[model samples]
Target: MVRGIRGAITVINNEEQEIIKATERLIKEIIILNQVAPENVAHIIITVTEDLNATFPAKALRSFEGWTYVPVMCSREIPVPKSLPKCIRVMLTVNTSSAQADIKHVYLEDAIHLRPDLQLTDRHL
Candidate 1:
């Protein structure tokens, strides 16, 4: 069955390097935690806060081997008041045998506050 893995990370700044590095880190962590293979990934959708316009998060994935062929899209997140700043989020649609409750969702840096209930412990991954 196809499952969706969610991940988000907060960037310190809107700099291109910062955005790229944070995005790569978030994606890598999600992949590692979920044991997601590129072949099993149907597509990825990334969103960034309005404050983050330095670069598209999907651009960072292109640098990884085997990710070039993966379908990726980037967009701006809904600008809610008092929302987290400089945040980048991703939803990876992947084919996995695991049940929905068994999937690992990654929330890094300050983004961890966004999903306290679903947040992972150190040993979870």
Candidate 2:
């Protein structure tokens, strides 16, 4: 079966390096928590808040070792009024046997406010 693992993070600015670094950090946390392998991944869908267009978060996954072949996409989030700003969200689709409820979704930095019901601990970083 395939599952979608979601993760989000907030960056300090819209700069390329910061966006890339923050996104990579978010992906790493998801992989670590869920024990995801690149070979099992189908595709990654990344969306950034409308304010964060200075860079594509998918670039971080490309630079990620062993992720070169994994399909990834980037888009802008619906610009809803009062929505979180400078946030990057990722939906990782992977071939996994784990049940949907068992999948680990990550929220880091200020993005934690997006899903307090999930009860995720603060990221070590």
Best by TM-score: 1
* lDDT tens per residue, model 1, 1-125: 99999989998889998999888988988888888989999999999999999888788897889887899999999999999998999999999999999998999889999998998777342
Question: What are the per-residue Cα lDDT tens digits for candidate 2 across 31-61?
Answer: 9888899999999999999889888889998
Score every model by TM-score. 0.95, 0.94
Candidate 1 similarity to native, TM-score: 0.95
Worst 10 residues of 1 by lDDT: 116-125
The local distance difference test score of model 1 is 0.91
Off by over 4 Å in 1: 123-125
lDDT of 2 at 105: 94
Q: lDDT (CA) for every model shown?
A: 0.91, 0.90
